[model samples]
Target: MPVTPGGKASDGTRADAGALAGVEECEEAPDVSLEALGSVATTTDASPGTVVPGSPAGTPAGPVSGTSPDREAAGTGSGRDTPVERLEDPGNSATERGTGRPGVAEKTLEQALPSVLADGPPKVLAELARAPQRSRAVRRDGLRRMGIATGLVALLAVVFCAVQVLRPLPGPALVMTGAPSYTIAGAPLTPAWPGEGEAAVEVEGVGSLGAYGDQKPIPTGSMAKVMTAYVVLQDHPLKNGDDGPVIAVDAQTAKESTAPGESTAVVAEGQRFTERQMLQLMLIPSGNNIARLLSRWDAGSDAAFLGRMSGAARQLGMNDTTYTDPSGLDAGTRSTAVDQIRLARAAMQDPTFSAVVAMPRVTIAGVGQIDNNNTDLVDPGVIGIKTGSTSAAGGNLMWAAQQTVGGSKQLILGVVMAQHSAGASDYGLAKALAVSQKLINQVRKALTCTTVVHRGEVVGYLDDGVGGRAPVVAGADLTVIGWPGQSTQLTLSAPVTGLPHRAKAGTTVGTIALRTGQAAGTEVPVVLQHDMTTPGLSQRIARLR
Candidate 1:
């Protein structure tokens, strides 16, 4: 066999060499060895009786014209039958030969020239070339479906957002309407002792203990005089009490201050007493007459003092208090328990007010000092405050007390107004005292004890129950009821407005006035329980020592 290097056929005959005469023999009788020719053409020529091994062993064979390159070329001519050869060669099977069997033909104009001129183009051949472009069309349909799906998803998202935006929120967190602190210990503290009304002790930045009967307007008895004294003291101080400035009792005061079944300092018409003497009579004795005198000295008339009282009430936001006279003798002074608590907190801020209210007794230079009649404050823990009594207004009083809690000082104010009247025995002073005791007990129970630090050391406890029992802090002066459970709203007012930092612990800070509705509320002493001053480096170092 002759072989060509580099996969070429060289000058070899094709498989059809024996089937046809040679080219030179085409013009004459050809002389060729079929066997030699068949060998070169890659075919077999066997006798009728011979057998090929891979074929049926005993089968007689014809001239074998196995698949050859020429046969494939021949099928392209004559527009004749082209055997639909199974595109795969089963015997050689793709995996056995590294060069796999031919796939579906992809016809091009240049390579398919002969077929194009014959029966146009085979339908299968034309379609085979178009398969790739048709695949793109299928992918386009999928993209269209995905686009529609995305649009539906976006629409649903928008609808959900709209529904959420249109919905409403929950309602306000309210437990009860109106004030709830009045029903303390099964008694009312409004318009009288244990009278029904709202009240609270609000230490700024700390929580409030009680919130009851803050809206009612009821008589506050002699407690109204607290406002009168507060206003007078705010505007005027004793002109050197030892010198004893003559305060002539005016006729208008004697007439206006007189109330049926109301106590007076027994101030006679034109009777003169020092301002200091008047204050003792007014606060210690709870004298309606002396209140009138102080009012006349400061505002020139009880009506003027009453007007100032109302104005002050408005400034302090005592919306429920009303005042007709400064003495609280029941020409119609009124307030709620809560308003009185406000007034008490405001009055307790003044140093002088605290001193005056806390003194057990005092003697005037010109006139002999009267007894401090408020025995309720004589209790060791009690701090004496002001008291008021009148038949119409009932017995009313404001007092403050202190106790240790969580290593800190906690102050409490108790107020009583419109208490049940005792039948003419010392003007219900005894009943007022009883009411004060009851109020004190309620306050002590309401206080939640906790500990707090002052100046980096554990000082005391705060009763406000705001958590951590931190240091007790009172920003303004606070007033308390001299009597217990007085029903009236309290409003706080300061003469100079806001307080200063670095106020000494125990320093008077502001006023707590107790009153009922739009009336001048009574004032009480309020003091600082903790130091608010920031220390300098030197001061801090010294403190360490």
Candidate 2:
């Protein structure tokens, strides 16, 4: 019995007996059994002892037709001589398996070597078993990076908030009020006394010289007309050269002008006058009737007009002044020289009043030109103001004069009240005029005007906070007038820690105020003389002192 390569019978019939013969032999040699080599040897219909590809070299050829090698060695097979053939190459064996060819078998050694050395599949299987631990390590690294980034952002946010809270805020710039001051070289000469009542003198830009007697209110007489004109102008404002609105005279005002001992322009009903013309008539001639007429025209009644006059007095800071009548005819109408000086200063600020009061005389349509009753108008440098006279009020004069002192025109305003006549033969007007003239002369001689600060001159220095200094200069020339031998003081106003860096030249940073005596001082603008640049960090730190 013969078997095929697939272990089937060669005659195409059952042959269990021949298959059992090799089984017993394989059992006897267990180490070299067909199962251990993963295949069994078989006989094919080829020539006897022919070797197949992939068979081990130097081993017995495939199954012999007559007797098998194992059976022959064991002396258990029928005797028959079979020739053996050499085995084919291993590369040819792999080619034969891949192609399933019956006889053709050819391949290179390089091709067979790869199949014998391949271990990729096994290595990939080993790595797959340990994948869980590697994945966990990657996840942990990502989380650590994210934590570090979040912590860095939070630290930067805290640092920003701290810097904002600790930084300093800038302060406000400086400011100045009032006027400048001047100094004199010698003691001022005092004026001679010639009046029986209170008298005082005041320079326009300077302070009051002195006052005599009590400051109690005395009869103002016709000086009350000054307030009358002031209130009228306030209600109907008139500029310096304006003719102002027309005011018609009423029949009732004409009747009042005929009152006994009252000064009158004798204005009749239906007469028309401009505001400027009416002011001249009332102020120049000291007309009581014209004053009352203006009062009635302004407030619709003399009483209401007097109320406005009292309010105007308080507004001008004249606390001691009282107005009982527009014309000052009432004995109750009284004021002090100090209060009158304040009133005079305010009234003269109006250009129309300043022009009208200085005139010696003026004419009207209804009445001929009347002379100003102020007798001192003829005196040297004497300007026309008002004059008042009565037995009870004595004589009162509010006068202004312009005199050259240190080559500048000085406007001197003086007032004398309750000046009485020496005897029954003379009038108190003479005493009032004499006293006012003497006082004006004394001020004109004692006071002098001087230029205190020149434009672009360095008035002082500004600290730059790092031990460096910058020049502070006046923006313009400043001049002031004061009595001889008076002391002048300079006050500076600026920022608390000086000016900031990079301040431009010509920028106003502060002010220089000059004070003389007890008067309100004047102020001049202070500016940087040159551009101030910011100091370097090292320079600022080094010059900390």
Candidate 3:
């Protein structure tokens, strides 16, 4: 009996026909099994001559036909080989069946590559571990260099700050230079007279109150003629008895002074007189020709004399004053009240200047001289200053007086310039006198020596020494104010009364004024005005009774 390739009986062979034969054939098929077909397969081949278990082939080299389980499986099934499972025991353990080779399952990329890379160390750490080591000495040197650089930077910052703090920028330095603050005791030192004019109060040491108006510039009229006289007296001294000095009136002076529509002393042409008489005519009569004659004599011409006037004014600190002509007739001659007061203060200091200006009359030596017509200065206490008039400058006047208080004599100067009205010249003069008198009284009341003395044998000897039952006169007519108190110091602003200059009878002799205190305060007249000469004893005693 033959078996088919599919492990079935052959076509001509019967199942019973080959029962014994088929059994032999089946036993032989195990030796020719498909397990022997694959190359390099580890399974053992069971072919011819192989042994079988429980078979008549003697060694049992081959499986028995129909009795061996493997032979039965190969014979009954189709020819394809099936997988083999080894049996360890009757009830086999499945774990014992695996081969020594790992049964590795198939892996996706997601699980394999990522797991490998993640488990490895980073490349940078690996490289650093292989780098060279720095020595301890090199590390110390680097730290020291860093510390030095930091300290140098900090030192530079401190040096810059010190330089900025110590240095000073250049500019102007701080300093101060001026007069100490002082107050004049009186009513706010008003323009003593009205409407911005110049006044010349007679003063000693400084000269007539010419500097008063010098503060402001304005045209001066007849008053400038007085300045012309002032300049002449600066050079020549006029004695009271020396009436023979020759004063030739030049032709030019005669023509210019007596020109049509000009103010004149009416000196005849070519007339000659003493210097003393010319000064008297110039001042007492307000003579224009006399001013011209004297100017020419002193400085060679009126124009030259005016030059000296300017120089004198500048020397006296009259910065605002200017003189275009000798007589103030030319509206160009001008000054302020402040400058005029200065000039007057200067004039009162000079005995000769005071005498010439105060005289009411003079006797000419050679030909013609005139009596003074300035009635304003006739009063003994009313010292002659100067007067001026013009169409533009108007009427102006300045005067001064002296009075005694507490046995001390003082002088008060006043001025009125540029009173612009017709027939107002005397009005300014009267106003000046009235204001000055008031000032004198205010100062006297404030003085420390305001002692009241009744009419008696002698209250005290006057500077003039005209003694008798000296009439008790009010220092200044206390019209504006009744009285002033103590704590006010009255000093003689100028000098003692009866100062040897030609003065009027019953003229104000001195000005009594209070001292300026810590703050600006008031000043008034303290002593009484008196005549230069006193009356007889009978008249004084009558007044006393």
Candidate 4:
């Protein structure tokens, strides 16, 4: 144990005092122990029977040569034949320490940690550094997905913008300003009244002239057949010359034809007749039985046909009219004079109905040649319309006449209802004809065609924004049939300031609407009287004030 100057042992061995001092200094370390260090430092002198500190009780010390008895027993001193030693000792060099035991310098606190947590601060710092990298990777993935969504949204927006840019534009909207009104200069012509009846006259395009007496519903003897013919023609349509669908005359129709006091057309059972021929027999001869027969053939029943007749009356604006039966033989069938005129106007619109009513006589296969009972058909300018007469209805006539008024053929539709003669011998037919003739003469004398706007006449002006105005003139002679000395209203429609910079002379600029009385007005196209040219900029600027 004697120390030399170099701190060696008395036997000239190195004392290892410095290494033991180094091990003592390491005793201040949290994981190193003095007991564990003493065990390693005393290992050089320790006998095989000596126990080491901090080792398990009875754990024998190894040989000082750092070899074990097992190595001696094996009679070999190879490098693998070494004994285990404590790790807290710094006295032993790493070369002296056996490979079976980890040296204190080699086994650090970090290396002594459990295998699961063997990596210490540097490993944690490395993992922390890698944490940011992992976070960045996640963020990058999220950003990549967000960028793809943004790209898709941007693509959709681009497509929508392209569609909108390529879509067509609509035209400018035009606004309607006003319509025209009128005032008649003199007293309007009035029609003569038949006895105990109402009368109304309606010109084709000129509305109703006037109505006399109360328009009360009155019985129509045979005139209800006109509606029967109208409904049948509407359901089974007949062209001007086309013979329509055929209908067989059944036994019920033949029996009804022969009933007393009923107008008959001599139809036999099993007789087949075209719809046109049936209409001729019904309307021209005022056949009541044929009207019923037509009703049955068209609608399969008289009650259903009567429903259609009533519905047709309502549609024609005949508010005061009612039909209880298809034939006027039923006294319950009633209509007013004004309502009858409405019906006549609608019926005459059909060319076949008009032609059939105009016939003075018609010949049928079953019945001999039957003359039209409407005596008014023979009168000049008087067209055939249905006529009705009975004790309950007196006399009813729905008449249409084409009379020359102001050099234009004007259609005059009039209705006279409930006319009666003093005696039964003189029926009301003569009275109705006299009254109709008087009204026709009066209307013809009252109306005259007047030129409201002549061709090339200026009706309006188009402003050029510089004090210059271009005249808008009528393109054609605008004439309308109106009452004499009546005031005509002229309404002009044109763009006030939006005229093109350069316009041709014949370019249509507006319309001149001429109205006389309460009728629908006639329109004439208004054109530029002369070419319109834009004013110079200097002129426009000068007029800016």
Would you list the C-alpha lDDT of every candidate in the order shown? 0.52, 0.68, 0.49, 0.67
- lDDT accuracy of residue 442 in candidate 1: 56
Question: Per-residue lDDT tens digits of candidate 1, residues 89-199?
Answer: 455442323344344332212122222212212322343335555668899999999999999999997786555444332211111112322211324322223554333
Flag regions of model 4 displaced more than 4 Å.
1-188, 405-407, 425-427, 463-468, 485-489, 494-502, 516-521, 534-545
Clashes of 1: 106
Write the residue-wise lDDT of candidate 3 on 266-376 in tens digits.
656678767766767777767776676677778876677888999989887888778887777778788776666667766666666687778767665453555654456
The true-versus-predicted C-alpha distance at residue 276 of model 2, in Å, is 2.4
Between candidates 2 and 3, the lDDT winner: 2
TM-score of each: 0.47, 0.62, 0.44, 0.62
Tens-digit lDDT track of model 2 for 451-478:
7788887877666655455677888876
Model 4 per-residue lDDT at 148: 100
Once model 2 is optimally superposed onto the true structure by TM-score, how far is the C-alpha of residue 351 displaced, in angstroms? Answer: 1.3
Better of 3 and 4 by lDDT: 4
lDDT over C-alpha atoms for residue 408 of model 4 = 66
Clash number for each model: 106, 5, 79, 0
Measured over all alpha carbons after superposition, the RMSD of each candidate to the real structure, in angstroms, is 18.1, 20.2, 31.6, 19.6
Task: Flag the better candidate by TM-score, 2 or 4.
Answer: 2
**What is the TM-score of candidate 4?**
0.62
Which candidate, 1 or 4, would have the higher TM-score against the true structure? 4
